[model samples]
Structures are given as structure tokens and as C-alpha cells.
Target chain A: MRSHARIGFVLLLTPLVLWLGLLIVIPHIDMLLISLRERISFGVYETSTAQYQKALTEPLYLRTFWRTAVMSVLATGITLLIAFPVAYYIAKMAKGRLQQVLFMFCLIPFYVSELVRTFGWMILLRETGIVSNLLQWTGLADQPVEMLYNDAAMMVGLVYTSMLFMVVPLVTTLESLDDSVIEAGYDLGGGGFSVLREIIIPHAMPGIVSGCIVVFMLSLGNYLTPTMLGGKDSLWFTEMIYNQFIVRSNWELGAAFGFMLLVLSSVIVWGMLRLTGRTLQETMG
Target chain B: MIPTIPQSRSFRLVYGGYVLLFFLYLALPLTVVAVFAFNDSQFPSLPWQGFTWNWFFGDSDPQIGVFHERGILRAVGTSAIVAGCVAMLSVAVGMTNAFLFNRYEFRGKGALYVLMLLPLVIPGIVLGISILIASSTLANGVWDVAQLDIQALRPGLLLVVLGQFSFITTIATLVITARLQKFDRTLEDAALNLGATRLTAVRTITIPFLMPAMIGAVVVAFLMSFENFNTTLMLVGSDAPLTIAMFDRLKEGSTPLLNAVSLLLMLGSSLLALLVILFQRR
Candidate 1:
């Protein structure tokens, strides 16, 4: 029986070990090695930091990385602000059936692909799109306005794409908060704003931290929204990675950028967790 | 139920308006996309000429519908195949992972668990690129050593399936493990005590109980694989999935035909999402 159990354990463990080792662990380590080397000639290579050096020195790469990071942080912040009240209402205010329905509505858009969501945004924000037509009809603008290709449009698309991620975590955490706790704050002469600041925010910190992490990562690594909505000059760092890998065939530089992005996102996520007094295991779980 | 706090009428009114506008913002873009799919216009935007099914059904020059567009149709089929493959593979691996985590006591178990969750946090683009670089390097090494070529290591549909499976399996494992954690061990123990072998007990009792979550994981995994764009973009070769194909067409600018495709995607995914939610509710 002991021998049989041991064999059964190995049988179950083999696939998982292969899946994680081959797909997750080995590839990342290989990428790190690739990034650390330079292709000296057609078939020869030398170990060097030139790829990382280029990522630092090149104005385009540096600027785009900065822009992507800043924009991602901004997008996360905006999503948190917008999703809080809605999540609160659904988690606390709405009645049982309505709560479920409202949450479902929040999830419906996300069920569709991000490409479709981006397409929907394009249809609404293009030069002759619905919003432009509405504006002209209301005499706000005599000529059609091209709203699709810009940073603001990109931000809108990012926020829209990331809203559900933020909402789900926030709702989950907020729903778990005992109602009596909040009632206690109110009964103890706490005003709405005070209670929220002192009680609700503290309680929802884990949710806020987790939601922000997911949203920030999504926004930072997002290739579709920024590219389509922000036009050719989107200057997104992920696009730079894409260009390097596909167009330039510069895998070394692309690997470097990829690592930089991984680091940048990790730092932000770690910093956010630290500030909120949470751990990766805790927040993710 | 007691209200958390007393609110003034003005506060309630303002909050109500905010909530109303919030839902509108969520609904507006999808509504426009769905509506414009039927619009009889060259472009997807503005000035609805009239209602028409030409975008979905028209055939011939300048009016080829999505159904007739061979590239779009092929991409849809490719996506379905890739999604089905990914769903099955991820579920199989995910169920095993659940067992490994739940049923065993091993060293580094906590570390392995965290490692499993690592893919979830890693950016999808990075995952795709790493796999791309790693596979090519592997292919090059094999060629150098053995003078043999391997086409499967190159970017293609197989890579796409593998790339999606990398992360989707994490989610799948998480979902299945949740259901498994709730399972009563005593039932399996009872079966064992009743002269049943371990395999038979699991096959008849444990597997049946986990069937719902396993099905839910399938639908969830399928939706994720079908909608995956970032990783698929990196690894896709000759065959483009629907998202990648749509992206290319959008880059060249699109007509209402694309909106027709979007509408169909919306309906299909909504139905799948509903199924997943129903299973979860059970």
C-alpha cells in the first residue's frame, strides 16, 4: 500500500513539475540569460550587458518605459477611485438579488474580449463616432472631433479595461466586512466621511491593495488598449518590446525590456503591498 | 437589514446619480458596438444609414460579410480549436495540481504553491516573449548538436496553446482546489473501509463531486484562451486567432463587418460567461 501510494504521488506530481518547470521557471531563467548576452556576430555571441545598456541609453526606450509606468500607476489610481463607490454599493447597499444582478452587470463587459472592448471604444470615440455625432448635434462642435488617438482616449480605454478587475477584488473584500463594524462607527458619532476614512478604508486596505496591483499590472503590460486607442505614437513600452522582437528581430534588447517591465511592475506591486501593510501571499490569496 | 449610516436626501440623490452614470458608462460602448453591427454603412461609426444584415451575410466584392471573409472565418475556427485544446490540457494539469497541493505533504509545498501563482502575476507579454526566446534557443541548440530541425518549437498555434495554458492553468487550479477543499474526506474513507480500492472510490465518489468545478474550469479556461491576445500575439504564426485577426484588420481600419464579428463574439462569450457563473453558483 505504501509503495502504491508513492507511485500514485509521482504520477500526479510529474505533470505539474513539467508544467511549471518547462513553461514557467525554465523560460524565465533562459530569458534572463538571453538578456545578459549580446549577439556579437551572425552566429557568434558574447556575454555582455549591452542590451540592458541600450535600454537605459536609448531615449525612446527610456521615455516609453517611464510613460508606461507612470500611466499604469495613474490608471490604477483612477480605477480605485471609480470602482470604490460602486463596489461598496453592491457589496453593502444593494438588496440580495439586486446585488447579484449588479455584480453580474459589472462582469458582462469583461466576458467579451479586450479586443472587442477596444473596438467598442473605437466605435464610440472615432472622428465620426457616436460621441462626436452627439456633440455636433448639440452644437458643441461644428466639425467632427477625432477623439480616438490621444493619451486621454488611451486612459479611458485602460480604465474601462481594468474596471472590472478592480471592482471584483473590492467587492470581495468589502462584502466580507461585518455590517456591525460599520454601524458601530456610525453610532459612535462618526460622520460618513470620517467613518469611511477611519473604518471602511482600513478594512478594505487588502482589497484596495490587491485590486491596485492587478489593475496596475494589467495596465502596464497592456498592449492592445494603448496601441489601438493611442494611435501609432502610443509610445507604450510593451509595443517597444513587440517591435524589438518581431520587427527588429532584436531578441536581446526585447528580453532586456521584458525584464525591465517585469522588474518595474514587481517594484510597484511590492511597494504598494508594503505601504498597505500586506504581503504578496496575503494579497493574492 | 440596517442601513450603515443615516444619509440626507441630497446625499442619496447625488449617490444615485453617480451610480446611474456609472452603469451608463459601462453599457454605452457595448451598446454602440452591438447596434452598429446592423447599421447599413461603410463605416462602423455614426449616421446609421439603415438596418441591414449585409455585414453578417453579404457575399461578393466590397460587401463581403464576416461569415464569407475566409480569413476571419478561418481565424474563428483556429481560435476555437486552440481554445478547446488549451481548455482540456489546462484542466487535466490543473486537476492534478489540485491533488498535489491538497492530498500530499511535501517539502517546499508552500514555495511550490507560490510558484504556481507566479504565472498569474507575471505579465502575459513577458510570459509570451520568454517562451518565444526559450523555445527558439532550444531549437537552435538541438540543430547545433544533432543537425535536426524542429518546427514545433517555432512560433505557431502550438506555441499559442502552450502560452495560454501556462497562465490559465493557474486559474484553473485555483478554482478546482477551492471546490476540493470543501470535499468531505470521510466519504472517501468510508468507501475505502467498505472494501473499495482507492481508484474506485475516487472514480465513483470524489471525481463526481469535483465534476461541477471541473466543468466550470473548462468554460472559464475556454473563455480565457479564446480572448487571450497578448501572449497569442507573440506566439501566433500563419494562423491568427480572432483577436489577432481583428487587431490586424483594425490597424488597416475596419468596416461594419468587423462590428458584426464583434457582435457575434459578444453573444458567444456572454452565453459562456453565463454558464460559468451558473456552475459557480451551484
Candidate 2:
């Protein structure tokens, strides 16, 4: 029986070991190693940090990376601000059936793919699209204003894409909080803003941090939304990586840029977890 | 925020209005996508010409509907096959991971568990490129050493399956493990004590209990694989999945046929989502 259990353990462990080793762990390590080497000649590589060096020295690369990071953070912040009240209403304020329906509304759009969602945004924001037409009809503008291809459009798409990620976590955390506590705060002469700040925010911090981390990572890594919405000036760092790998065939530099994205995003996420007193296990789980 | 506490009328109005607007923001885009599927115009945008089904059924030169569009139909077939393969593989491996985590005491379990979740944090594009590099390098090495070619280790549908299966399995395992954690050990113990072998007991008792979550995982995995773009875009070769095909077309330009495609995708996925939700309710 003992050996049988041991054999079963090995059987289960085999696929997992193979999956993680071949697909997840080793590939990332290979990418790191590839990023460290420079193509000295055709197919002859020497180990160097020139790829990373180029990432740092090139103004285009540096600025794009900075913009992606900053935009992602901003998007996360905006998602939280928008999603918080909705989540608060669903979790704390709404009744049983209404709560479920409202939450379902939040989830239905996400069931469709991100590509479809971005396509929908394009249809709405393009020069000949609905929003422009609505603006003209409402007498707000005379011309069909081209709204597609701007930072603001990119931000709207980012926030819209990530809003549910924020709201889901916020709703989950907020639902577990006892309503009596909020009532107690109000009964103790706390104003609405004060109660929300002192009671609700503290209680919802775990969800807040987790949601922000996921949203920020998503926005940072987002390819379709930024590229589709923000035309010429998108300047997404992932585009740089894509250009390196697919367009220019510079795999080494692409690997370096990929590592920079991974490391920078991870560091910021770690910093967030530490500051918020949450473990990764807690957040992700 | 407390329901029991009465708020001012202005506050109530504002909160109610915000919720209303939030749902509108969520619904408007997809609604427009669906509604325009029936529009008579060639473009997917506004100025909706009177209603028509040309985008869904038209087969003419300029008005080719999604059903008649060969590229899109083939891509949809490719996506379905990929999603099916990914769903099966992810669930099988995910079940193994669930049992491994739930049924045994092991060394370095905590660390391995965290490692399992690491793919979720790694960006999809990074995961895609890393896999591409790793596979091609391995293929090249094998070719150099043994003059052998391995097709699986290349940028293609197989790579897309592997890439999606990587992170998706994490989700599957999490779902199955959540179900497993709640299993009553006594039922399996009762079966064992009642003259049943361990395999029989597990096959009949434990597996049936986990079937719902396993089904849910399958649906979730399939939907995720179908909708996946970032990883698939990086790894796709000659055969593009539906999302990739749609993306390529969008880059060049779009017609109302794409909106028709979106409408079909929406309905198909919503049906799948309903399945999972209904199963969960059970």
C-alpha cells in the first residue's frame, strides 16, 4: 500500500514536473540567458549584457518603457476609482437578486474576448463611429471628430478592460465585511466620508491591493487595447518587444526588453504587496 | 454605504446614477457590436442603414457574411480544435495537480504551489516569446546533432496550445483543488471499509463528486483558450485562430462581417459561460 501510494505520487508529479520544467521554468531561464548574449556574428553568440545596455541607452526604448509603466499605474488607479463605488453598491448596498444581476452585468462583457472588446471600442470611438456621430447630432461638434488614436482613448480602453478585475476582488472582500460595523461607525457620529475612509478602506485593503496589482500588470502588458485604440503615438513597450522579435528579427533585444518588463512589473507588484501588508499567496489566492 | 442607514436624497441620486452609468458603460460596447451585426452598411460603425442580415448570411463579393467567409470559418475551426485540445490537456494536468496538492504530504509543496502561480504574473507576450525561443532552440539543437526535425517545437498551433495551457492549467487546478478541499473524506473511507479497492472507491466516489468542478474547469479553459490573443499572436504560424484572424483583418481594415463574427463569438461564449454558472449553482 505504501509503495502503491508512492507510485501514484510519482504518476501525478510526472506531468506537473514536465509541464513546469519544459514550458514555464526553463523557457524563462533560456530567455534570460538569451538576453545576456550578443550576436557577435551569424549564429555565433558571445555572452554579454549589450542587449540590456541598449535597452537603457536608447531614448526610444527608455521613454516607451517609462510611458507603459506610468500609463499602467494610472489606468489601475482610474479603474479602482470607477469600480469602487459600483463594487460598494453591489457588495454592501444592493439586495439579493439585484446584486447578482448587477454583478452579472459587470461580468458579461468580459466573457467576450479582449479583441472583441477593443473592436467595440474602435467602432464607438472612430471618426465615423457612434460617439462622433452622437457628438455631431447633439450639436457639441460640427465635424466627425476622430477619437481613435490618442492617449485618452488608450486610457479609456485600458480602464474599461481592467475594471472587472478590480471590481471582482473588491466585491469579494467587501461582501465579507459585516454591515454592522459600518452601521456602528455611523451610529458613533462618523460621517459618510469618514466611515468610508476609516472603516471601508481598511477592510477592503487586501482586495484593493490585489486588484490593483492584477490591473496594473494587465495594463502594462496590454497589447491589443493600446495598439488598437492609440494609433501612431501608442508607444507601448510591448510593441517595442514585438518589433524586435517579429518585425526586426532581433530576438536578443526582445528578450532583454521582455526581462525588463518582467523585472520592473514584479518589483512594483512586490512593493505594493509589501506596503499593503499582503502576501502574494493571499492576493493571488 | 450601509443600507440600514438612511442617506441624503442627493447622495442616493448620485450613487444610483453612477451605478446606472457604470452598467451602461459595460453593456453599451457589446450591445453596439451585436446591434451593428444586423446593420446594412458595409462598415461596422454608425449610421446604421435599415436592418438586414447580410453580414451573417450574405455571400456576395463585397458583402460576404461570416458564415460564408472561408478565412474566418477556417480560423473558427482552428480555434475550436485548439480550445478543445487545450481544455482536455489543462483539465487532465489540473486534476493531477489538485490531487497532488490535496491527497499527499510532500516536500517543497509550498514553493511548488507558488511556482504554479508564477505563470499568471508573467505577461502573456513574454510567455509566448520565451516558449518560442526555447522550442526553436531545442529544435535547432536536435537538427544539428541528429539531423532530426521536430514539428511540435515550432511556432504553430501546437505552440499556442502549450502557451495557453501553461497559465490556464493554474486556473483549472485552483478550481479543482477548491472542490477537492471540501470533499468529505469519510465517504471514500466508508467505501474503502465496505470491501472496495482504493481505485474503485476513488473512481466511483471521489471522481463523481469532483465532476461538476471538472466540467466547469473544462468550460473555463475552453473559453480562455478561445479568447486568448496575446500568447496566440506571438506563437501562431501559418494557421491563425479566430482572434488572430480577426486581428489581422482589423489591422488592414474591417467590414460589418467582423461585427457579425463578434456577435457569433459573443453568443457562443455566453452559452459556455451559462453552462459554468449553472453548474456552479448546482
Backbone clashes per model, in order? Answer: 0, 0
List the candidate 1 regions with Cα displacement exceeding 4 Å: A231-233, B1-4, B280-282
- What CAPRI class is candidate 1? medium
Tens-digit lDDT track of model 1 for A47-148: 999999998998988988998999999999999999999999888889789998999899998888998888889989999889999999999999999998
Give each candidate's fraction of reference contacts reproduced.
0.74, 0.76
Runs of candidate 2 with Cα error greater than 4 angstroms are: none
Q: Which CAPRI tier for candidate 2?
A: high
- The sequence of per-residue lDDT tens digits that candidate 2 reaches over residues A45-77 is 999999989999999899999999998999999
| Top DockQ model | 2
**Chain B TM, cand. 1:** 0.97
DockQ of each: 0.72, 0.83
Clashes in model 2: which pairs? none
